[model samples]
Target: MAAVRTNGERTVNRLAIVSVLIITMIFLAPIYWIASTAFKPRNLATTIPPTIVFTPEISPFVKLFTKRSQLRAPPSQEEYEAAPWWERLVFDGGEKVVRSGRGEVQLSGYPSRFMNSLIVAITSTVLAVGMGTFTAYGFSRFKVKGEDDLLFFILSTRMLPPVVVAIPMFLMYRAVGLNDTHLGLIILYTAFNLSFAVWLMKGFIDEIPKEYEEAALVDGYTRMQAFFKIVLPEAATGIAATAVFCFITAWNEYAFALIMTNRRAQTAPPFIPSQVGSGLPDWTVIASGTLLFLLPVAIFTFLLRNHLLRGMSFGAIRK
Candidate 1:
């Protein structure tokens, strides 16, 4: 009977592993496709039937630095032979001009766009997470009238999709001179990220025993003093976790950024689509740009993963 039970448990564990692997692949497929597409040359990028296995080329990677246009037709054999060594690898202009016949082609602005996203995301995370800590603490510790209603109202903001408010918000931002500004995006992202942040922090604060703060009060610490020295330390894990979510939300936000900012304030999200030229969008450049964009966020998440894990575990624990 014991052997039968052990075999059954092993079977269950194997099934769980299989299920997790399937789900992981489902989530990662698009990311893998994007990375793959980013490495292909223009011709093979959007090929019909989708080339799952094909020769890899360096042309797409080269275009990451310079803007290049598509040709009316493939280059002739003689043109391919006469091409400069570097051009052969990237443009291979051949018969048709590899570059746009129009005026000067400029280098891509991905670096600046990446910086814009990084700055706005970090700023917004700080604002949102800081405000969340205060609001959650207030809700958990202090008595206030209509508290449930206030909490519900806060949560309601997240239910209405950002698309619904983009146009109205755009007009409002323009009138207020907040459009196309880093500060503007920071404030907007903070507002959008606040709902979840507040609730998350509130839960973490609630998990901490009130007795800890009460003891601090008896020892002559004021309510605020007790909060800072006692409650805040125990809640570090939760704060770190909430910060990760806030950062990720602000990092990936697109609708508001696209409608509300341009030029000086534009972020990586909107600028990625702009990489494609007048013709069919170059999958390679777009892919390469996207890969570059994915790296910073990945690095950030990696750095904070330990704190995130602790917070998650603590949040799951209950009295």
Candidate 2:
């Protein structure tokens, strides 16, 4: 009987492992496809059977960052041999890099658009999370008038899809001459994320003991000092989790970014798809842009993975 029980346990464990592996593969497949396509040569990107294996090329990434035009004619043998490796990749793809008169390469808009995404996403995330932490600390540690009602009101903002407000928001942004500025998107994302940040942070703050702050006060620390010294440290896990969520929201934001900003402050989310030129769209370039776009959020989350794990389970159990 004991031997049979052990066998059953082993069977269950094996099944669990198999289930997890299957789920992981399912989730990772599209990401793998994108990464693979990003390195595929241009002609192989959209093949009927989907080429899974090929000689990887960095040309797509190069083309993604450079302005290029169709080659009028094949490069002379000397020209081909003399060109730099990246320029050779472009030349092989039947396109020539657009160059300035002084012989400098003219870059595409992707790099600036990528930078705009970083600036807006990172800045707004910080603002939202910072402001939310303070507001949440107040709610968690102090008595406020109509606290429940106020909390409900704050959460209400998230109940509606933000895109629903796109039209009015666009009009307002235009009226203020903020239609294509980084600050405008920053403010919008910060506001959109604030309610969520506050609520999430409040939970984490509530989990912390007020006794720590009281002890700090007894030690001659002011409320601000106690908050910075005691409460903030205890709530670090929650803050990391909230920051990740807020950053991703701001990073992947599309409709608002599309309508709110044009050339000056356009983010990667809106700019990547618009890379389709006059001919058949270059899927390789698009894929490369998308793969690069995925990196910042992935890295941010990976760095905070420990905190995120703890944050998710932080308040789930009580002594």
lDDT of each: 0.79, 0.88
Off by over 4 Å in 1: 1-23, 54-59, 68-106, 276-278, 297-319
For 255-302, candidate 1 gives per-residue lDDT tens digits of 888888888899999888775659667687788888878876788678
Candidate RMSDs in order: 5.1, 3.0
Residues 1-319, model 2: lDDT tens digits: 2443677798987898999999999999999999999999989998999899899999999999999999989999999998999999999999999999999999999999999999999999999999999999999999999999998888777667768877888899889898889999999999888987898888889989999999999999999999999999999978988898889889999988988888999998889877775778889899999999998778977886655644344324322
TM-scores of all candidate predictions against the true structure: 0.77, 0.90
Candidate number with greatest TM-score: 2
